[model samples]
Target: MNDTTPDSLIPYDEIVQEALRAVVGRVLGQVEDAGGVLPGAHHFYITFKTGAPGVSVPPELRARFPDEMTIVLQNKFWDLAVREEDFTVSLSFNQMPSKLVIPFSAITAFVDPAVDFGLQFQAVEEDEDDLASAENDSANGASERDVASRITSSEDGSNVVSVDFGKKK
Candidate 1:
């Protein structure tokens, strides 16, 4: 009797990740359809990799947050644009108005505290070097782990999707 399990050739992780990202897109699309007005107390905390491909942030912001950044979309946000692969919005940072373009693939965490719903995604790196580079980058004040911890703490009736894959080596 062999205790070892063979790894499947299917890319289930990627498929699942894409499906989860679509959820984010659909939610944003709803907001977009509503003329950028968030009904009631529904707000979002979106965290993404600042250095990821197709990400367009202000130069100063990119310099300040070289690795990851989180933005709140509750009030004071305008020009909300949602697309299939990404979204763009205008937000104010320290009294400076700026527009940010973030792709779904760059998103790492999305949380709506009003409904206690959150989703955390794994950062997809192109190669081991990119992974090492990202690991060495400066840490953000609010990380995916922090978001997950906060969301999971109120686990009574919360809807949080956080998948952890353990790769065999």
Candidate 2:
């Protein structure tokens, strides 16, 4: 392992991150395919970056959240649609229904309260100028605001809860 150069190929960190993102997609897909009832006490608290590419959310929400937002998928949500790169769902806000389209790449955390299972990821950085411009854009202005308003955790903990394959033999 010592002989291997770091730049030789894709890093394991990225590979693991991608794989974990896939888990989010698969979970959402299952909910969509099964007509929306999560079995047992399973529920999810999904936290994602509001300004990430391919994320679609209302302007008011964006303005309210600003940087990152955590959504609970439990008692109320609808129109769940899962795609290869992202997922869309309709949820109520102040009794008004709102739709959100979130890309897997935007996800920072996925937590299931039922079993205290959780996965946290590194927040990917983008070009600062582009992000600033996007924040100023009318179309996503509200979302950017929302992302900024929401609270974010400082701890970027383990990406998976169930397994610890990092142990050396």
Off by over 4 Å in 1: 126-157
- Residue-level lDDT of model 2, residues 45-85, one tens digit each, is 77778888889999998987777677778878989999998
Model 2 ranges off by over 4 Å:
1-8, 126-169
TM-score of each: 0.83, 0.72
lDDT of each: 0.77, 0.69
TM-score of candidate 1 to 2 decimals: 0.83
Which window of ten consecutive residues has the lowest lDDT sum in model 1?
132-141
Q: Any idea what lDDT model 1 has?
A: 0.77
Would you list the clashing residue pairs of candidate 1? none
Q: lDDT per residue, candidate 1, 1-169, as tens digits?
A: 9676578699778888899999999988999999999989998878788889999999999988777777878888999999889999998877889999999999877778888888878875543433322222212234555555544544577787876565765
Q: TM-score of predicted model 2?
A: 0.72
**Worst window of 10 by summed lDDT in candidate 2:** 132-141
